[model samples]
Target: MPSRAPDDIERAHLRDPNDRRFTIARRLPPEPLRAWLRRFWIPVWDVPDGESAAQRVLQYPVCLSITTPGYSRFVGPNPGLSTTVLEGRSWGFGTMFAPAAGAVLSPGTLRDLAGTHCDLEQIPALAGLTEPVRVLMAEDPSAEETHAACCALVEERLERLGVPGEEDLLINAIVEEVEGDSSLLTVGQLGERFGLGERSLQRLVSRRLGLTPAWLIRRRRLHEAAGALRGTEELAELAARLGYADQSHFTHDFRTSTGSTPGEFARRWRDES
Candidate 1:
């Protein structure tokens, strides 16, 4: 995959400026794990007592997160933006799984988890790994140590479950194609390009990802739009570029997903900086 250039407006998608109470760091897993793992992300936050900050995200297609003082859980894809409020001092380490990789650790289809979370220990494949991880996390390990521990745990689980199957690879490819290509404007376009009928495409995504193809496409487009809003582009042009019919349509969708209009979002980033 081509790396994003420094000036690429899409880089803003990786972060949010509305909340400055935390720092996030990411590390790639070992090469052998790249097919099923995207990266391990650690977020460390320190806030004054009685105050809180809201962290919002245009989350990826799927994730399996482990948090300190919280249960390890598998989070499926959500159709809209997700937000969490942070208070006091806190930290969390999470693995952003490839679209189909979650299925390997899940007891049922990914659709069952869509827009929801389940305790990771409930999954037979992940049952025994959480306790050791909890012990390691309690000691406040360094980033490198945490990454190594997570990699090792995942490796052990993969050994027992076997490598992700062909279906996983197929789902990963479809997600990558849509995410990497901005020209893919609609689910129908994706269906045609992937050579699957619209209904079949929806079924495949629902079964493996627990999300509708339309939701996936809309989420990707909204992510791009949110990123571009942090830059200087005109709303109409950005909306058209993202395949919206007009500026009004884009504004409505953007506000609905992010709770702020494009202009207000950009201005907040500008004023914050």
Candidate 2:
């Protein structure tokens, strides 16, 4: 298990500092696979006999490959928040694919799979990964050797997909730029920076990530808010900094996506911590 303080973790995850039901660890893909693979994640969990814990994520706009004891599948971009309930003792081995990998992995257009997932066995090219990863995670869910073996298996499979092309790399750049820079507030600003017109940028993101540029921006803002609210920052000041028109608009956006007001969320996080 990786020993990371809750406050130091990635903002995309909505983690409770007091929750001890699960542990997560991350490993980077080797250099050659970086163009297609982001990183590998292994999460092992144990809950009391009759209770359950819910894990939430503000997912990135990319595809995912996950294998657990009972299932193996490819997950498309999630349009909003993602939640999974956990019980008993178990583990999951997952690959967070880069933006460029969606086109190569999807049997049809990536757009068709948004907000959904497909079984790995349903896709012939990736079917080889299903059984091997399942067996490894089931046999030794917590060993470093087991995790390394899983990554080696995936590396072999993804290497056959070949190198990402120029357009594929461009899409990667576009997505990274949006997530990395907070000052990029509008789609027009994004397009101007990339030398792409509005329509062209829209079509490109739709084709590769199965998401609109506008939605991506909104999601980033919410993720930032989720992290910031853990502190003592004033709501109005936080809203202004994140480019929201007003605090009312900020509260509405946060509640719409998270089912909790910004103030409510901040209080809950503080109470737990």
Candidate 3:
């Protein structure tokens, strides 16, 4: 029998019966794009249809993804922050004051982003930050966890630098709200809580987060809803707790974002715990 090649949109690899860590074969050409940013991107990996040996990795960097359902490219950046896009079933988001130019970045765009080993490992007096210099940055398993941890660490670093506490406070606030309950966090609320005008906070957060406050709210709530459905609650209650008006709303949003319903997701596989 002739062996079939991998299809576009599916990354395939030879799988070992035992030892399931991660396996990536290859991917197809990304679908062409109309616009760069301003929406979520759907990159069908140009790999084969094979079991993802990787235990659905939950960790990666934390950079707000801004692309459309159409493509994974980006336009000009939100000021004061940068992102290092990576490849995986998941993505990342975080906030960092854009470092000065001439600094190294992760392997996102390297015509080349990394110059030398010194730049790669320097850690820039900002300790928690992983320089965008890793050849295998995207492949790291604990990527998101590490990035979120870095954000927390950078909070302390900025404090030591005598940066005004508000910006860092605001970052922590958004992170907490996103990590917890985004249903209640609003841009207007952030402005009122921090005494900044709405526009000002919007600009600040957009610059730092690379996303609007509403995006953060939606991302966090959706994330929580997914967690609740898989780990904690039934679909009906999960939808309500995550602030969806009802289960149908939850199903719609979930299918739109993840291409699956709560019941489908829950029943598709056994709990890994």
Candidate 4:
């Protein structure tokens, strides 16, 4: 396997150039499935004996379905950073699902499973896929055909769900709006833009996404902030662009979530880059 750049660098994750024990490949889903699934990522790792490496992700505000040699799970939207450790020579096949698709695939409401995961075998639609996906990944974790076969299995399962319902489409659109528009900084603004009342919007988001509308805005800003910090933009200007009242407020929020001040994070990013 060869080292490839991340599919979306703005999305936060921890990586070390010195540790070249892993290679990841990400491919977009088929066009018809794009509305429900974001992409498929396959990561193959070969850590040396007696050593371990950690992979951290500031996950997007959506759900994930990940299959590894040991386990297969349906992971809910994580409200904060997530970390996974890797050891030995192994691989993982994971999919980032759209906001609307979580409820459809999860055994219970999204609200019940936030920040946690359940066995994939529990989900009727996804049960049969675990073993086959695992076998294909094990055979050739770095092969293009392996990736396509995994995707094909998922696509076949999802096609049985038929067209997404009206609410599913609405939530997908709502997430798209929140992610694309930097000007939407508050729940009120999001409600107005979507013609939904605060409580109604809150209910919809919490039920389908297991998160508050406010979290959606903050996550988007932080993701953009992390990406922007890699550049040379002034802190004050960056804060203003992301709808923060001031740089201090922005720094406070970033520090609270990431345990490091924006300046410190930026410096580390620069040093690492």
Give the lDDT of residue 195 in candidate 4.
95
| TM-score of each model, in listed order | 0.89, 0.94, 0.46, 0.93
> Mind giving the per-residue lDDT tens digits that candidate 1 earns over 185-257?
7888998887899999988988877787887788888888777777788888999999998999999998898
Best model number under TM-score:
2
Q: List the residue pairs that clash in candidate 1.
A: 111-210
For residues 103-172, what per-residue lDDT tens digits would candidate 3 score against the true structure?
A: 1222233212221112222334433244331222354423434333333443444344433344544555
Model 4 lDDT tens row, 55-134: 87778778888999998999999998788999999999988888888988888988888899999888888888899998
Could you tell me which residue pairs clash in candidate 4?
A: none
- Top-lDDT candidate index: 2
Off by over 4 Å in 1: 1-18
* Candidate 4 global Cα RMSD: 2.7
lDDT, model 4, position 95: 84
Residue 114 lDDT (model 4): 89
